[model samples]
Target: MKGKNALEMCARAEYGEMRGKNAFEMCAEAGYGEMKGKNALEMCAGAGYGEMKGKNAFEMCAGAGYGGMRGKNAFEMCARAE
Candidate 1:
């Protein structure tokens, strides 16, 4: 269990460092990867808008999925593919 936990932490830390972003930026509410800064539901509104457009959560929240979906993050820009 400890090893698993450590591995998870290591992966997270490495992910944060991949794009020169810190813990906060990587975990930003509006998302940190590609979405960067969309503030409307449109980011996660339709399809292939936010997630597919941004770098991380922005991929699942505001731009990743349909009726879009982190890959976007959160509710606003949940529509990308980070």
Candidate 2:
């Protein structure tokens, strides 16, 4: 999906006041784990999925190794330094 659509869906997941199965499924379907940049981290973190959080962290590391800070820097730094 496009960055905008992913971001909008994430925003909807965050503040649309939707909850339970629908919200969880929507967040899962938004492909938040596959998103890039800060938006990806925010959405993944906010989604409250343990697997998604781990995936996001891994993506962040890969992005860092690729030499692009984007959203990975913070995650990688925190994970490693901890």
Candidate 3:
């Protein structure tokens, strides 16, 4: 049981990392990669928008599915292909 929980946590961390990396790549493609201060790529790559004190780019892209849903991560939204 302890191993299962550990694996689950590891999987969640990996998932978040993948999501952040993908978000950064997508932002780069869309020309939102760079900025004068903190770049969008960094923002997406590291903590994402949620950790920046609000919702992440992926969650915002989710539209209606994430409407009014507070305290939920981007993983809850089915906007991106998994």
Best by TM-score: 3
Winner of 1 and 3 under TM-score: 3
**Candidate 2 similarity to native, TM-score:** 0.20
Residue-wise lDDT of candidate 2 within 6-81, one digit each (tens)? 3343344443433222323444545445542234345545544544454453463444434343355433433333
lDDT of 3 by residue, 1-82 (tens): 1223222332333443333334334334343334223433344444334434343444443432334534334444322223
Candidates 1 and 3 compared: the better one by lDDT is: 3
lDDT, residue 58, candidate 1: 37
TM-score of each: 0.19, 0.20, 0.28
Considering only N, C-alpha and C atoms within 3 Å, which residue pairs clash in candidate 3?
A: none
**How close to the true structure is residue 72 of candidate 2, measured as C-alpha lDDT?**
51
| Global lDDT scores for all candidate models | 0.35, 0.40, 0.37
Quote the lDDT for 9 in model 1: 32
Runs of candidate 2 with Cα error greater than 4 angstroms are 1-4, 8-48, 57-82
Best by lDDT: 2
Worst 10 residues of 3 by lDDT: 1-10
Give the residue spans of candidate 3 off by over 4 A: 1-24, 33-41, 45-66, 78-82
Per-model tally of clashing residue pairs: 52, 0, 0
Per-residue lDDT of model 1, residues 2-81, tens digit only: 22222233234545343444333444333534545543333333224433443343334333334433123342331121
